[model samples]
Target: MERFFKLKEKGTDVRTEVMAGLTTFMTMAYILAVNPAILGTTGMDSGAVFTATAVASAIASFCMALFANLPFVLSAGMGLNAYFAYTVVAGMGYSWELALTAVFAEGIIFILLSLTNVREAIFNAIPATLKYGVSVGIGLFICFIGLQNAHIAVDSSTLVTIFSFNNSIKNGTFQSEGITVVLALLGILITGYLVIRGVKGNMLIGIFATWLLGIICQIAGLYVPDPDHGFYSLIPSGILSAPASLAPTFLKFDFASAFAHPLDFFSILFAFLFVDVFDTLGTLIGCASKADMLDEDGKLPEIKGALLADSIGTVVGSCLGTSTITTFVESSAGITEGGRSGLTAVVSGIFFLLALFFSPIFLAIPSFATAPALVIVGFLMIQQVVKVQWDDLLEAIPAYVAIFAMPFLYSISEGISLGIISYVILHVAAGKSKEVTPLMYVLAVLFILKYIAL
Candidate 1:
C-alpha cells in the first residue's frame, strides 16, 4: 500500500488514509438518502434509485481511486441530478429515459473533451464571477427544493407561502402537515447547530437524528402517517435488507427518442455538459488545493485521469440509471483529515458499496428528514457568493441574474442562458468586448438563438 499509493512521500499512512476515507464517506453518505428522494420525484422507483445511487457512487469513487490516484470521491452530483429530474424531465417534459440518454451523451462528450485542451478552454471561457454565480444559483435552487420537499414553503395565492400550522389546526390535519413542517424547521436548527459545533458528518447525523425524531412522533401519535397525502410509515420493515433490483431503471436510455428531438436533446446535453464540466473542475481544484496537491502552476496533477474517471462515472451511472457522476467537493472532508492518496477514495468507495445492503434504512428516510441536509449543503455551496466580484456591476449584474433566475424560474438551463447572454451583451454595450472571450460570444449567441428558436 505504501509503495503503490506513495504514502511515505505524501506523508500519509495506510491508517490515516483509511480514516480519511471513512471521514469522507460519512460526510457524503447523505446522498444515499437525498439522491433517491430528488430523483424519485421524477417518477423513478425510489428503491431502484437508491440502489443505483450506491452502485454508481461506488463505481465512480473506485475509478477515482484506481485511475487518478487522487483522494477525490465521485457520486451522482446534486445540482446535476436536479437539472436531470427537475429541469430536463419535469420542466422540459422529456421522458426520464431520454434524459438518461442526454446524460450518456454528455458523458461521452466529456470523455472527448477530457482527452484534449478543449475542456480547459471552455472552463477558462466562462468568467470566474459567473461561475460563482452559477454555484450560488444552484445552492439557492437546492435550498428551495428542500423547502418544498418539507412543505415548509407551500403554494399560495401569492404563489408561495410558509406552511400554516394555524390552517392545519383548523383543518384538523395538524398531525400530518403541521408536525412535519415543525419537524423540518427543527431539523434545520439541529443541523445548523451541529455545523456550528464543527461536527464531522453533521449533515448525516442531522438526517438520522431528524428521522429518529419523526419516528418518535409517529410512535407518540403526534404525527400520523397519511399515505394518501404522501406521508408514509417512517419505520423500516427491517433493519437489514438486500439491495433492490436495478431492473426498474437500469440501462433505460432512450437514444432514439432523444435524437428525434434534436434541438431539445442537444439543449439538455449542453446543460448537463456545461454544469458537469465546471462543477467537476471546480470541485477537483478546490479539493486538490485543500490537500496541497496542486503543483506550482495551480493545476492538479493527473487531472486527465481524474476527468476520465469522472466522465466514465457519468457514463456508467447513466447506464445504471442515474444522473451525471462527478468528483465531489465533500471529498475535502477527507482531505482535511490527512487524506492525500487514492487509498482514501478506495475506502470511501468500499463504504458506498457496503451501503447497498442497507437500502431499507436509506429508503425509509423521508424527504423531510433529508431536507435539512439539502438546506445545509445549499448553505455550504452558497458560500461561493463571497468569491464573486460584487463591486463590478458588469460582472455582478449577470451573476445576480443567474443566481436568482435559477430558483425563481425553476430551471438551471434558463439561469445559464440568461447569465451568458446578459454577460456578453452587457460587456459589448460597455465597450469591453475585448474582455469577452470568443467562446463567450458564441455561447451568448447560441443561448439567444435557443430562446428565439426553441
Candidate 2:
C-alpha cells in the first residue's frame, strides 16, 4: 500500500511533495485567461467565466496533486483555449454555452478512451516526426494564442498593425497604460537576466517583481474606483459568493447538446482526447527529460498517476465550464526556474486558486504587460525548428508547416491537422511511402477530414 505513491518506499516527504505541487502551479499562472477567453466567446459573461476558471483550475490542480502523484499542474491548455475562443466561438459561430457543452462531452469521451486503453494506443501509433512537430507546434500555438489575448497585434488590410510603446514613449508624455507595460517588460528582462546569470527561481522572482509593480500602481492611485463603491475592487469571489457558492457549477454537466448532435460532439471529444493526452505526455516527458526525472529504465516515476489525474481533471473541468484540462508544457520554464519535484506544481496551483481573490489584480495587469512574454515564449516554442533537418523535405516541410500553421491558422488542432497531412503527402510524394506507417495514415486521414475536408 505504501508503495503506491512511492512515498513509504521512495522515502518521500509529504511537505516536500506539497511544495512541489505548488511550484508546478506557478509556472501555469498565465492560464487564468487562457481558458475563460476561449470559453467566454461562447457567450458567457466575462466575470462569471473568470470566476469559473479560478474554481475549476483549483479543483483540477488539487486533483493533479492528490491523484496523479506526478509533479505536474493542470490548467486550461494555452493552444486549446485559443481554439475554443477564436475557432469555436468566434470563427465557427458557436455559442459559448454550446462550446462548453462540447468541451464537457469531450471530457466524458476521454474518460471512456482512457478506460479502454485506446487513448494511449492511438498515441503510441503516431509517427515520431509528427510527435515532435505536434509538440513544437503547440508551443508556437501557445505564443500566438497569448499574443492574441494580450491584443498585441491587430489584423488589418494586408499586413497587420502591432501595438508597441517602444521608442514611442518619450519626453515624459507617456500613456497611463505605459506604466504596466514597462513593469511587464521589466519582468521579462529580469527573468532573462536570471536565466543568463544561472539564477534559481527566476520565474518566481519575475512574478514577484511584476506583482510588486502592481502594488506600486495601486498605491500611486492608478486603479482607484468610485468612492461610492468604497475604493475596493470587486473580488471575483464576491461576485460568485466564494468557497461554497462555487460548488454548484464547479463540475456541473450539460449533456443536452450531446444528445442533440451526438456524432459531432463525439468527434470533438476524440479531438480533445487526442490533443490532451499527447500534450500532457509531451509536457511530462519533456520536463522530466530535462530534469533527469527518468529512472535508469527510462521510465518516469509517477507518470501513470499523473496521467490518471490528468484524465480525471478533464472530467472535472468540463463540468465546471472550462475546456479539456491537461498538464502544461511551461513547467519546463519552472524547471528552468530551478524547481524540482512536485513542490513546484503545488506552488503553482496554490497561486492559481488564490488568484480568485485577485481577479481584478490579474485583470489589472493589462495585455501590453504580457505581450513581451508572448513574444519570448513564441520564440522559445519555435526553437525546435532547428531539429528539423532541412536537408530532407520529408522532415523539413511538415515541420515547417506545423510550426507556421499554428499562428497563421489560429487553431492548434488545425495546425496539427495540416502538419500531419503534409507529412503523409510529402513522404508519399518523395518516394518514402513505404516509410509512411499505417498509423500515420490513420491519423493523416482523420486530420484531413477534420481540418481540410470537413
Candidate 3:
C-alpha cells in the first residue's frame, strides 16, 4: 500500500489517510439523501437513485485512486442533478430517460476531450492569479454551503438571515430547527477547538461528537424528529439492510426520443458538457491548490487521469440511473485532513461501497454534524488569498471578480466564465493583448456566446 500510494513520499500515513477518508465521506454523505430527493421530483425511483449514487461514487473514487493517484472523490454532482430533474425533465417536458441520454452523450464527449488534451490545455491556460482566486472563491463557497446545511443562515427578506430562537423561546418549547442551529454552532466551536489543539482525526472526531450530542438531545426530548422540517433521528434505525435493486434505472436511456427533439437534445447535451467541464476544472484547481499539488505552471500533474475518471464516472452514473458524476469539492475536507495520496481515495471508495449496506447508520449522521468540518476546511483554503498579486490591477481585478462570483452566483462555472471574460477584456483594454493566450480569447468568446445563446 505504501509503495503504490507513495504514502511516505507524500508525508502521510495509513492511519491519517484512513481518518481523512472517513472525514471526507462523513461530510459528503448528505448527497445520499439530497440526490435522491432532488432527482425523485422527476418521478424516478428514489431507492434506485440512492443505490446508483453509492455505486457510482465508489467507482469514481476508485478510478481516482488507481488512475490519478490523487485524493479526490466523485459523486453525482449537486447542480447537475438539479438541471437533470427540474430544468430538463420538468421545465423542458423531457422524459427522465432522455435526460439521462443527454448526460451519457456529454460523458462520451468529455472522454474524447480528455484523451485529446483539450481539457488539460484549458486547465493549463488559466493564469496562476486566477487559479489562486478560484481556490479562495471555492473556500468561501464551501463555507456558505456549510452555513446553509446547518440552517445557521436562513432565507429572509434580505436574502439570508441567521436562525432565530425567538419563536421557540416565546412558546417555551424547543423546536428541531432551533436545536439544530444551536448544535451546529456548538459543533463549530468544538471542531475549531480541536483543530487549535492539534487533535488527531479532529474532523472525524468533531462529526461523531456533534452527532452523539444530537442523539443525547433527542433522547432527552429536547430535539424532536421532524422529517417535515428536515430534522430526523440521530440514531440509526437499523444496523444493515439489503442494497436497493438498480433495475428501475439501470441502462434506462431513451436516445431515440432524445434525438427526435434534435435541437433540444443538443442544447441539453451542451449544458451538461459546459458545466461539467468548468466545475470539474474549478474543483481540481481549487482543491489541488489547497493541497499544494499544482506544478510550477499552475497545472496539476496527471490531470488527464483525473479528467478521465470524472468523464467515465459520468457515463457510468448515467447508465446506472443517476445524473452526471464529477469530482466533488467536498474532497477538500480530506485534503485539509492531511490526505496527500491516493490511499485516501481508496479508503473513501471503500466507505462508499459500505454505505450500501450501512445506509441507516451513515444517513443518520445529520448535516449539522459535518457542517463544522466543511467550515474549518474552508478557512484553511482561504489562506491562499494572500498569494494573489494584488498590486497588479489587471490580474487583481479579474481575480477579484472570480473570487466573489462563486459564492454569490452559486456556480463555479459561472465564476470561471466571468473571470476569463473579464481577464481577456482587461488585458485587451490595457493594450496588453500579448499577455492573453489565443485559447483564452476563444474561451472568453465561447463563454459570452453561452450566456447569449444558451
Candidate 4:
C-alpha cells in the first residue's frame, strides 16, 4: 500500500488516510439519498438511482485514486443533476434518457480534451483574479445552497429572506415554526466551536450532533414532513435491507433520440461540457491548494490524469443511469483531516461501496445535518478571497461580479460568462487589450451567443 500510493513522498500514512477518508465520506454521504430523490422526480425509479449513486461514486473515486493519485472523491454532482432533472427533462421537454445521452456526449468530449491537453490550456487561460474569484463564488454558492436546504434562508416573492417563525407570525401562522432554521443554527454553532478548538473530524461530529437533535425534535412533534419542499420527518422503515435493483436505470441513455435535434442538442451539450470543464478545474485547483499539493508554479501536478479520471467517471456514470460525475468540493473536508495521498481516495471509495448495504442509515440523515458541513465548507473556500488584489478596479470589478452573481443568479456558468465578457470589454475599452488572451475573446463571443439563444 505504501509503495503503491507513495505514502512517504506525500507525507501521509495509512491511518491518517483512513481517518480522512471516513471524514470525507461522512461529510458527503448526504448525496446517496439526495441524488435519488431529485432524479426520481423525472419518473426514474428512486431505488435504482440510489443504487447507481453508490456504485458510480465508488467507481469514480477509485479511478481518481489509481489514475491521478489525488485524494478527491468523485460523485454525481449536485448542481448538474438538478439541471438534468428540472431544466432538461421537465422544462425543456426532453426525455430523461436523452439528457443522459447529452451527458455521455459531454464525457466523450471531455475525454478528448484531456487526452489532447486542451482542458489544461483552457485552465491556464483563466485570469488569476477570476480563478480566485471562482473559488469565492463557489463558496458563496455552496453557502446559499446550504441555507436553502436547511430552511434558514427561504425564498420570498422576489428575493431570499431569512426564515424566522417570529417574522412569519405577522403574516399567517400565530405559533412558531421553522424548526429547520433553529436546527441549522445549532449545528453551525456546534461545528464552528469544534473547529475553533481544532477538533479532528469536527464537521462529521457536528453532522451527527445535529441529526440526533433533529430526532429529538421528531419525538417532540416539532419536526414536520413537507415532501414538496424536501423536508422529511427523520423516519426510517428499517435498519438494513438488500441493495436496490439497478435494472430500471442501467444503460438507459438514448443516443439516437438525443441527436434528433442537432442544433438544440449541440447547445445542450455545450452547457454540460462548459459547466463540467470549469467546475472540475476550479474544484481541483481549490481543493489541491488546501492540501499544499500544487507545484512551485501553482499548478496541480498530473492534471491531465485527473481530468481523464473525471471524464471517465462521467461517461461510466451516464451508462449507469446517473448524472455527470465529477470531483466534489466536499473533498476539502478530507484534506482538512491530513489526507495527502491517493490512499485517502481509495478508502473513501471502499466506504461508498459499503454504503450500498447500509442505505437506510445514511438515507435517514436529514438535510439540516449535512447543511452545516456545506456552510462550513463555504467558509473555508471563501478564504481565497483574501488573495484577490482588491485595490485594482480593473481586476476587482469582474471578480466582484463573479462572486456575487453565483449565489444571486444561481448559475456558476452564468457568473463565469458575465465575468469573462466584462473582463474582456473592460480591458479593451481601457486600452489594455494586449492583456486579454485570444481565448478570452472567443469565450466572450460564445457566452453572448449562449445568452441570446436562451
lDDT of 3 by residue, 1-454 (tens): 9999999988999998998898889988999989999999999999999999999999999999888999999999999999999999999999999999999999999999999999999999999999999999999999999999998988899999888788656368878888888899999999999999999888889989999999999999989898887788899999898899999999999989876889899999999999999999999999999999998989898799999999999999999999999999999999988988888888888998999999999989999999988888889889999989999999999999999999999999999999999999999999999999999999999999999996
By summed lDDT, the worst window of 10 consecutive residues in model 2 runs over 232-241
Best-fitting candidate, scored by lDDT: 3
Off by over 4 Å in 4: 167-177, 224-229, 233-236
lDDT of 2 by residue, 1-454 (tens): 2354555443445554544444345445556654555565566555555666666666666665566545566777766777667876688665556666777766666667666766555545545455556556756765655455434454657555655666436665544444555555676677667656755444455556665665666667564333353233312223222332444345444567667877766665565666666566556644555455656544555655566667777767667667667777665555444445455555566777677765545544434344444444555545555645677768777867876776676655566667778888988888889987787788788766655534
Rank all candidate structures by their lDDT, best first, as comma-separated numbers: 3, 4, 1, 2
lDDT of model 2, residue 420: 71
Q: What is the C-alpha lDDT of each candidate?
A: 0.81, 0.59, 0.93, 0.83
**In candidate 1, what are the lDDT values of residues 105-188, reduced to their tens digit?**
999888898888666565456676777787778678768878988999999999999987787884455667788888889999
Stretches off by above 4 angstroms in model 2 are: 1-24, 33-52, 62-69, 78-101, 133-135, 143-161, 164-172, 214-241, 247-257, 260-307, 356-393
Error of 2 at 278 (Å): 6.4
Residue 430, model 3: lDDT of 100
The local lDDT score (0 to 100) that residue 309 gets in candidate 2 is: 62
